[model samples]
Target: MFVSLGNLQTLYLHNNDISSIETGTFSHTPRLQRLELYGNNLTSIPQGVFDGLNQLQYLSLYSNHMKTIPPNTFINLQQLLYLYLHDNEISSIPTAAFANLPRLQQLCLSSNQITHIQSGEFSNLPQLRELQLQSNQLTSIPTVQYQFPELIHLNLHNNNITDIPANAFSNQPKLSTLHLYSNRISTVSLTAFTGLANLNTLYLYNNQLTDLPDYLFFGLSSLSNLRLQDNDILQIFPNTFTGISSLTYLLLNGNSLKTFPSEELSKISSIAVLYLQNNQMATLSFTAYDMMLSDVSTVDISNNPWQCDCQMVSFRLKMTGSNSFENQITCTDPRHNRRLLKNINPEDLTCEEPMIVRFEKGDDNSVEEGETLHMVCEASGIPTPDITVILPSGLHETVESGGRVIVEVNGTVTITDVTAADAGLYICIAASPVGSAFKTLSVDVQSKEPATVTSAVINITGKPESTLGSAPIFSLPVLLGSVIGAVAGTVLIGCLILMIWCKRKAKNPPPVPDTSVVFNNTNTTATVTTSGHDQTGQGWSHNVTNPGYAQRPAAPQPTLDLYEDVEPPPNRPTSKGAGPKQPAKKKALKPPKRNKAPHDERPSPPPPRTGAAAGAAAVYANEPAAALDNLPYYQPLTKN
Candidate 1:
């Protein structure tokens, strides 16, 4: 096949039907500097096929049927500078397939079925400057990790990549151009291109991007072109273009943007070309119109559903004399359908007066103190009107007043922690350029009642008890103990009173009986000793004339002392004279038989005789029994 062509410097075997080759096909071409085997039907590459081609600097096996790359296929091609294996059926690259190619500068593996690439597959090629991997089946970009520090170009467009992760291209600091368009990229990390400081052109168009985050290009100072068109981007943040100061072209066409990035684009004074066509925008703001006329040179904002209402009058007036928007801007409103914005008369863009539809005049409302009050003041008009709520303090506030009252953009007022000072007439004014309307709400903030002091005073022991704000409650155990204590104190007071009354009755003694008795001196008036007389002083008498009385012996009487001054009886015989009157003999007194007394008819005790009458009765009771016996047989007279 090339057995003797050792000085071959360039060989073109492309566009042929060469499918099979021997292992030593390139062994004889040791000085070959270029080889092209593209547009062939080669299905496989044998190991060590280019073993002796040490000076091979260029190789092309593109548009072939090779499905895999052998690890040692290009082992001896150390001087390879260009490799093109695109438009093939190759699905993967071996780890060491291109390991020895130190001088490889450009590699084109685009338009292949390669779903992934092994890490460090192209690490040994320090001089690699361009890598084309577009129109492949790769789902995501590989993490190069500075493997190709000297590389300057990377093309990965039209792949199945779903998302661009953070620092996806950080290793490629010198990369000036990145082609990531026409992929399935729905989300891109905020720092996806953080280290691509020198990036000049970025193509992110024709993807599923919904929105661009703030500071997404914070460090891309050198970026000139940013193609974000043909995506589902809804809005571009205000700071999305903060660091791309040199950005000159911005393509945001064919997206779902209802509003333009006027604030973001106007800040970048270097933007030259602006594409906002085929979007859902109804009208552009004044800032966007001004930016288009002064800062941007080329502006294409056609094919949008423009609403030519009162709000679009300013934009239409600004576009009156400009021919750049001759047919690009048309109205979709029924009043001016398909009419060019520059052709419409400014006077026709009139609006109705703003009318407060939600709140009525003199709407009475009340709120308790320390409560929240929400009042809705909705209005309707051609253009949205600003709301202002005049507070009771005569202060006019639009959004918020101090910290207690807040007004939302949708015309709702929130008064939190309302106090008595917040009560009064609140006038809500909805004003716009066309006309103004208002609604009044009389708010009555009921003040809270003052705290009261309640007290309970109990005088249990004739002393003041406890005072409290409210009646105190006692537990069952405490209440039982208090009741028991009260009962014990009452019982102690009764017992002390009884003991004092009993001690006052023991101060008097009983009277003593008389110690002496007397008798009569005459025999006719003989006295009997009767110390046993009844309480009435009646003496007992025995009649000896009766037969029954003579049979019984007479009872002896108790002796009593006779008075020495009395004379003796004349009938008595004179006996030996007693030296002194002998004391009368005593006898034992018998206990008196008392008649049985009724239970309730006890006889009253006789009052003790304490005067001289008691002494006379005692004097007649000591007479001897012989003298009293003769007198009693003869009936003696009773004493009065």
Candidate 2:
């Protein structure tokens, strides 16, 4: 119907309810340079929608329900330079979809539902400079090799892209900037950015990269600014930024970097301003800063966990005095965690001597299993370096040195009764804020005979016994326990011997000593003697009387003496009614019974001396019984 105005230069049929377009719908608009049909009821664009509009340079089909972009959809509109297909329901772009648009400088499909695209889908757009496909459902680039020789800026940010395959920009000689930030990118191929010779800026911040490999940007020679902040980067290789000499601004903020990349930073000379803020770096030292990069305008190492300790604290103070890192540096350690580094006084940065650690100055050691192992490590530093031993089991053990496995306060590791499981490489770390040193000691516990270990002593100063030829020193507790055990065994043996002797003596008693009493008439003495039970001989004598035997009283006691008195009744007095009974014959005294109680030992009296003179008998016949009773007590000898 509008064919009457044949040479229409611009067609503004936007906000239309165009549900369908006939084949020749725009045949009469061949000279149409701009087409504005956005906000339409069109579900899709017809194949020949812009058939005769070869001069159409602006095509705005946004706010449409377009589902798919077919190949050769714009084959005739070679003059189309700005195609705005954002805010559409476009799911995929087919191959050769934009092959006819040779001058399309900005093909923006942002804010669309595009998830997939065929390989070489944007092949023929050689003049496309800025291909913005950000804020979409793209998980990855459509193809590995994107051939855009004239494309300068490619924005694929805010997409669901997990990876950018290798050689994604293989032929992009004029590509200067690339924005792939805010993606789920966890990995990038080694050659992913190998061919970007003129790429000056790259924004890959906010990704899931754990490490940056060496030579990642090998061919990014002109790369001046790189934004890799907010990534989970824990490690960066030695040569990660080797060839990127033009890297003036490197934003590595918000990472897990504990140590500085000194080697890589040394190679990058043009890094005028480097951003290493918000990392796990414990301290910033002069050694980490490259002296060659003196021309570096500034290096922002702020917001790092700066441990203000003796370890290179002097150097940190020196750097704090310089204004190059003025306002950008702040501490994250105790007492000054949020304080600025420049505000800390240089005098407050106390330091001790550097540390030196060694394993008694020896090489790898070997020991037999089931033997005592004494390993010694010593440190030389101010305020004494604290020692930690990392065992073969990968467990860090603080050597408090006690018991059988004693560790001396000066770093001596003594392991008594070491087994095969205790064999391994032991790393001794002598660390302090001043400095730290490490020594590796490989202990090979061999399974051998004798169960004896021959380990040399490494003394207090870490002097190896190989040179001194000294035995390994035993801990006090170990020696004490051994001596105690031996003494207890000896005491036990002595007690057992004593008990056996006692039992033998109770079973068979010793022979009784003979008791013999002799009376000497010449000396008028009666003697008593006792000898037994290893007792010395002893004697006591009593005097026999001339008329009557007057004797000293025996020692008074509860029990009777072994030889007590036994007197017969006095002879009956002669009377008229009683015939004079013959004088009772005087009985002779007999020896007391052996093994008898003192009260029961009643010895019989002996017969009168045979054939004594009749006159002598007449002297004793009147009171013979009385004479016998008058005799001195004849005490008997007692045995032990």
Task: Go through the candidates in order and give each one's C-alpha lDDT.
Answer: 0.74, 0.70
lDDT of residue 163 for candidate 2: 86
lDDT of 1 by residue, 176-242 (tens): 9889999999988988888888999999999999988899999999999999999999888989889
lDDT of 2 by residue, 322-426 (tens): 566656556654556677766777666555663545685234388777777777887776435678877787767675434555666578777778788888788
**Positional deviation of residue 628's Cα in model 2 after best superposition, in angstroms:** 99
Best by TM-score: 1
Model 2, residue 381: C-alpha shift (Å) = 15
* Each prediction's TM-score versus the true structure: 0.56, 0.54
The residue-level lDDT of candidate 2 at 601 comes to 63
- Could you tell me the TM-score of candidate 1? 0.56
Q: Residue 427 in model 1: shift from native, Å?
A: 27
Regions of model 2 farther than 4 Å from truth: 1-4, 13-23, 142-145, 288-293, 319-324, 351-640
**Candidate that would win on lDDT:** 1
